[model samples]
Target: MTRTALRICPLCEATCGLTVTLDGDRITAARGDRDDVFSKGFVCPKGASFGELDADPDRLTRPLVRRDGVLTEATWDEAFAAVQAGLRPVVEAHGPDSPKFSASLEQGGTPIAVVLGNPNVHTVAGALYPPVLLAGLRSRSVFTASTVDQMPKHVSSGLLYGDPLAIPVPDLDRTDHLLIIGANPMDSNGSLCTAPDFPGRIRALRRRGGRLTVIDPRRTRTAKLADEHLAIRPGTDALLLFAMVHVLFEEGLVDLGERAAHVVQADEVERLAAGFTPETVAGPCDLPAASVRRLARELAAADSAAVYGRIGASTVEFGTLTSWLVDVLAVLTGNLDRPGGLMFPLSATGAAPRPAGPGRGFALGRWRSRVSRHPEAKSELPIAALAEEIDTPGEGRVRAVVAIAANPVLSVPDGDRLDAALASLDFMVSVDPYLNETSRHADVVLPPPPPSRGAHFDYAFNALAVRNQVRYTRPVLPLADGQPDECAIHARLILCLGGQDGADPALVDAMVIDTVLGKAVADPHSPVHGRQPDGLAAQLTGRDGAERRLDMMLRLGPYGEGFGADPEGLSLARLLDHPHGIDLGPLTPRIPALLRTPSGAVELCPAPIAAEAERLRGRLGAVPDGLLLVGRRHLRSNNSWLHNVPALMGGSNRCTVQVHPEDAARLGLTDGEPARLKGDGGEVEVPVEITDTVRPGVVSLPHGWGHDRPGTRLGVAAADPGVNVNQLNAGRLLDPLSGTAVLNGLPILLTPVR
Candidate 1:
């Protein structure tokens, strides 16, 4: 029998609604849900091919355990037993007498319990359970994809607003002038800032007489849609933005408007930016002095404007400074919190709006890593430092690792070193669907059921979405016989960490519910105040612990029904009735109310940010010598994980080094010929792709490649395995403030292969 089911695409940040057709456990087709409230029938290539991804033959169906140095299939019970045996010692060893775990006791519990979170942490059980597990372990040794991708933005937001999670998204639907720097939303479908049809939004912006300006090394797909595109030098985003600030102050175009009362350090910003005039930074940025001033004028003169930057502005030596200046421009132009300007999203599941007042300010470097002493940012150690924490022998060395949907070997910088570091670990476990580069090193590999068999919710992406909307997707297909729910697997893993291997996984969920309900009932502001926790637990509705937890979150959320207090507000049952989704309307301005700083206002120039700006100012005259390297994005790809899907394998997504025609001619490089490229980390011979899109002094390589690692099971990916760009980084260079790997603006030596 054939049946159609509606679900949300879990592949990327867009979180578009998917209409999947299944015939007896096999996914046949996937298309856009026309009635979807947020996406509005928009489906990207990844969403359209969800069926093939869900039914990939290479996806493991059973748990695997390492026996005598070999991975072999094992029963679920055997896998749990093995995990309990492996991880229990690390969790129990808390005292300094335990030589195996000697991390600083002052920071937290033993540093033995470590976790590596992937981008997928935004979806599925990954969003729900991993935090619980980490909280239960109480370990300071944690790593996530954020450090490598978006940590700078988080740190910048934390410095400006007291909360690290309070990030602002561009009001794409209403903005009149959009200035995009170092991001290609057409390919990424918008990252950090989430929008379903980013390309469509750009087109609509053009139709509405809105001006779009893109500043990047290459003229990406997003840039092509812009009214103007500036092929700027890589890694000079901070310099360019600072120069823009200079022009704003010098030309008397600085307008804080309604933000005057809510903003601080305007004079400090002017003093800091005074030295970075357009003429001073034009040479390094490869842009004319006139162009820089004109851009500032356009931004300030526009009725509404938003300055947005992504991975390109981040993952650099001055990443944190660039991120901070992006918001500084928005504020200086009076676009921080207004219609057709940059604003914060009010998610349905987010905390209820609190009275704007002095709050506990955000802090950094609370704890330092053992070997390098790199300070922790937002409670996560830099992914760039994970190798040394595991390999270096000391009091705080990582003895065991728990990776959830992560592939640090391929994702992080210096894969060769991290690969060797994993081998030396006493034990490692990976909760992933594929046994690729990173998971291959695990002692036990637990594969979660495919997306079709699991429910969907965007706990993370929803908070970053351009619009305020809510959606849910029930399982499109039933769980296979004898297969366990992904949530159950996570719960069992938590139980194992807690030294109860064979216990019912449901107990883990129950304990969480009890703890949450107990806290809620005791909170004076809670709607259920004075109500018994046991009574509320009985009133919860769901088929399992995961859904029940969702129900609880929805009931307690800002737009929630408040347990019958507001009958028409959101609830799990209401979401179930509206399968496509419920449009909550467009983003509204949230300023003083969203500010959580100790000052109850936006801190324009924090000390740390000011110090970093000085560092950027010092580099205003220093010029980059060689052809700088930057990364590119392909619409067909979403990091290294998605290349294996046959439906998305071909077309313009092939891996190659993109070099500007002028640079190719100057270096005697030929198109379609391999070229030797060496950087601070290492070297690789990649085929040259000659194009005029990139600036003359810059070359581009798409990240998330190098599927050629041995002992992997990605059939399609390995066949055409591309070279790893991270290998060229050598893992030494990093952004000092954010500790993010410097993935872009790296100087490299290039020679054509004869």
Candidate 2:
């Protein structure tokens, strides 16, 4: 029988609500849920193609073990055994037969590397399991997709707010003016800043007579909608932002408003930005000095304004500086923590706000990569260094890798090198649904069941959401006979990696519950403080361990009931009762109460940020004359993930390099003609589309293509496999503060292929 069910789309950061039509156990169709509180009725192409993705046929339903030299189907027990065998060598101190897995590792064992992908935070398994698994292993070697994408934002936030996770999103519905730099939220559905129907929100801002300004090298979908679009030179966002800051201070327009009490170092910021006057940065940014001054005056004159910068700002040489300046602009304009400005969203599951005081602030460089000695940011070594860490002979080389929902081969820089590096690995294991680029090298591939058969929760997205809300969805269909749910798959992986193979998976959840509840009761800030852990453990409600963990977290969260301490407060049971979602309301001001910095105020002029600014001051007018390269995104594609979905790979999503008409004419390039683009790493020959949308000395290439790997099962992607844009990246260039790959504003050469 066919039925309908509601689900929260985990395809992207938008986190739209989906109403799925199921025919028996198969998903037949998926559309937007009109009743959804956060997303409303907005659904993008990725959400609409859910059925095709869930039934791709190429998705592996069974585990595969590399028996001898060939991969073959294997039982769950055999698959996990193979994983244990492969991981055992990496953790020499703890063998598969070790009795005390967690305790033995407390003293610190040999490093076991782990790489988590962006998709992990979308599911309960990814959100709840990895931390526990890492703890069980006690390995310090860590890498994640964040290092290649959004690490700069996290680093900047840590330096500004003391907590790396304390990122602020613009209050789109109320802002009077929004300055967007290096971001195309209309296509990305917003990253770091999460909002459903992002384009619609931008349109709504215009409808309300609010002004929008875009800073990019090319005219993007969001840029076209702006009141004015400034095609700034690539990698010069730091210069542009600091120039605006200089204007804000120069014209006596420094208004911190009520947040002045919670923000410090205004004079320090003004003094540091003094060298980056509009006239000085105009040459580097390739924009008119008058335009830069006008933009600053507009922001200062607006009733309320927000400056939002994204990947374009984060994946460049001065990424952290650009990110920090985005917020500094907001703070200087009296928009830091006010309504109709950039403010932090308080999710239902966030830790209850602690008393405002000095806190344990964020720190970096506690660890470094062995090969490059790249300092750690957010406890993650750069993924760009993964290849050398494996191929190079060293004492603490990454002998084995636990890749969870990650595909670094096609996603990160220098894919060719990493592809060859994987062949030399001692052993590898991947928790993935497809034998794709990175997973094909794994000794064991454990595929989680389809999304239809897995429960849904917004563990990470909720914290980054533009609106304060909560939603939960049960599994649309039950798991098949021998299939394990996502949670069960992760729990099993944890057990096998912990050297306690065949242990009851339930123990993983039980131990987590005991530890969390035990700690919550001890902390005076928790609502459940002074409560007996054993008594509250029996009171949690859920059908499985994952749900039970969610229940515990919800009960102890900011909006949660303290084990009946607050009767009407949030509980998993109450959230379940509301089918659509519980709207916790719009973002409110959270200033000194949320400040965790050592000084109990926002660090307006962090030392590292100031140093980066002074570094930019040295290159005020020295812009690269050669063509610079930057990446672009499409509404239907999300970095290499959606290319396999045939329905989402049409029209504007095709692979081609965009060049300005003037540059194309000079290089003898034409529309639909192949062009050779060379970079520091290597060269790629892609079809050129000459257009004036891009500025004269810049070219735009989309990321997440080049799906021509031989072992992958993505039939559609391989049919017209595009060139991997990342091939041009040698993995040498990185943002010093955050270690994020400098994927944008890199010097490149272009010529007609002839």
Candidate 3:
């Protein structure tokens, strides 16, 4: 028996570097790898608990199948056969499009071959998959967490810069002033901007004579660190941003000439913003007119300032508009793409690529749900409509489904409704690690091996990271007997369902070898490379001689005659040599140069957003005496994943209705008392935590809890299962443009549950 030190971290999108302490054959402890360049030894509480995930007693060690309405431990063959039998018919009848697969971005062992075998598999990170996978699916019905959160960034970037992937990263390191709206980067660990150790970054900014401001309804973790915190009303972010821009234009504070060359619809944006003066929109957003104007002036006067907005702004009724206006403010202030301002990622591929199409906004009825008429994005209806599509009888109905890693019944809007829909499916198969929540409804459950057994790539996170860097995670251990890898299980499913035999064994072997060797070549110290080698070039050419051209070019490129094997240059071997991680460098602004619009200018005030102005004003007029429900995020939870991890679930799991003390008194409720929240879908009784952290007339709840699944072995999470907030959320209300479920900003009635 021997012990070895390994560096790996796969907790969330942050991908912090980790040092695993091993004792013989067991992992004794985990700590942050201080020498890592990207994270710089930063590790979150979640990442520190990797040992628990590995040793959890409830972890599925073998496959399981439901027979006679009871789940029984079974062999891998039995499980695969059951899944194949159940899903084959669905593939035959509806084609691959009907059998949608949803998996988490971090799940291990998902077979790329199986995923690519069928065009129907839907992943949250579909944008990062290989070209073969993307080309095969070919349908607009695809739905993702992006539309519900960061679609605004994509849409705005595309409209203004001509490149959707050209999203701006807030250069916190160099920024003199940073304004964060509707976000808490401290807890989220920098959403859409992968900055590890965010707390330290904020502290450094303040230490360097920089200022930080947070505009949020709650005194979030990030707010506590801010130089100033503005408690604005929920769902009113767009208004606040508009007022900021309005003040900039009205007070002669804006440097229009600075941005004149890059701005596309500057005149249109100026005219539109004029209507949203601080005085007019301040009342709706519950902010003082003076504060709005002062903030706008501060932003405009700053030598370099960037306004960052995320989830809170993108998951509302006017998400697209709010997203659009945030960018408008950045551009109008002459900070759209500048150092110490909003900067773009310098990608290996130049820019984030999008699916080729009309390049217009979301369209309706291009493909509708068989039962609910819910608009389709690619070939799939929104997850919110999954239940109706399965239960309703009509042409193109979803009679069966093959879910991958995703627990939609718990994660989607209207959980109770989705559970019922899962029950109605003619056949259901789940490729997951546990028979919890959504998988309990499946006829067969195919579990993949643990994370340590899978090769890791941050394809999706790379596109969103604040800096440009790429790293691959190689499995630290070999697969155990009687269990198949994620890729193998997925491949089996695709082959069985498509009535096709498994891929050539040689091809499979070659792909696996390529992936492993490519990862090693990216490192600077692999045996194949006598010394340090450029991993990116290795990855590009690790295959049969095809990547040789790329390797030759990199060897001759200006960066160096040969891939510098040192930390100063870019190469995988160098990255591996130093386990701590390497800093790729700060992000730089790339707006007009990356803009793809016909006029080669940023579309500041696009027509689609302009046409909705009257409607926005009308909605702004109706915001009186209404309680808007919003969702909050915590560091401990990774949506539905961490509930089963004991260390993270030691405390409370019960959902809390965060109401302002004023609202609590007004509703005759007290802190820690039961409160009934009623909505169109249903009502749920949750405990109340009255705190001024929440603005008056607004209520908050952390999403992805309330696990009521029977036979689930998660003792910790089950001990204090929270109420499902989605049960009190309406599925009908959605962003018209993105068709993203409006998870926040629903008007609901609250009563004391007694």
Q: Please, what are the lDDT tens digits per residue for candidate 1 over residues 139-226? A: 7878888888999999999999888888888899999999999899999999989899989999999999999999999999998888
Write the residue-wise lDDT of candidate 2 on 1-754 in tens digits. 8989999898999999999999888888999999999999899999999988888888898999998888899999899888877776556554324443344333222346788998898888999999998777766668899988989989999989999999999998899999999999989999988899999999999999999999999899899999999999999998988988999899999999998988889999989988788998889898999999999999999999989899998899999989888899999999988988899999888888888898777887776777788888987889899888887774666678899999999889999999998877888899999888899998899999888889899888898888899999998888889898888888988888767788988899999999999999999988878989999999999998988898888888889887898999898999999989999999998887787889999989888887877787889869678889999999989888778888898799989999998999898898998999888778999999888889999999999998888888888888878899899989898998899999999999999997
Query: Cα lDDT of all candidates, in order?
Result: 0.88, 0.88, 0.66
Query: Each model's TM-score, in the order given?
Result: 0.98, 0.97, 0.85
Q: lDDT by residue for model 3 over 1-754, one digit each (tens)?
A: 5554555566676777777777654666788877666787788888888877766667778877889988888987777677667756545444435433322111111111121111112121122222323233232234444544566566556555555666777877788899998888787787777778878889999999988999988889899989999998877888888888888878888775455666666777778877787888877888998999999999988888888888888887788788777777777777766777777776432222222223343323355544455554433345666666556565445566666666766666787887887787777776677767877887777777776665444545655667766554455566787566665565555456645434432233244335544554555433334433344434443322212332332233222124443325443344345444444566765544555676666667766578666567775554567687888888877777678787787444347889998888888998888999998778888889988888888899888788777867666677778877788775887766556678877888999976
Total clashing pairs in model 3: 32
Instruction: Name the lDDT value of residue 754 in candidate 3.
Output: 62
- What C-alpha root-mean-square deviation, in Å, does candidate 1 show against the real structure? 1.7
Ranking by TM-score: 1, 2, 3
Deviation from native of the Cα of residue 277 in model 1, angstroms: 0.8
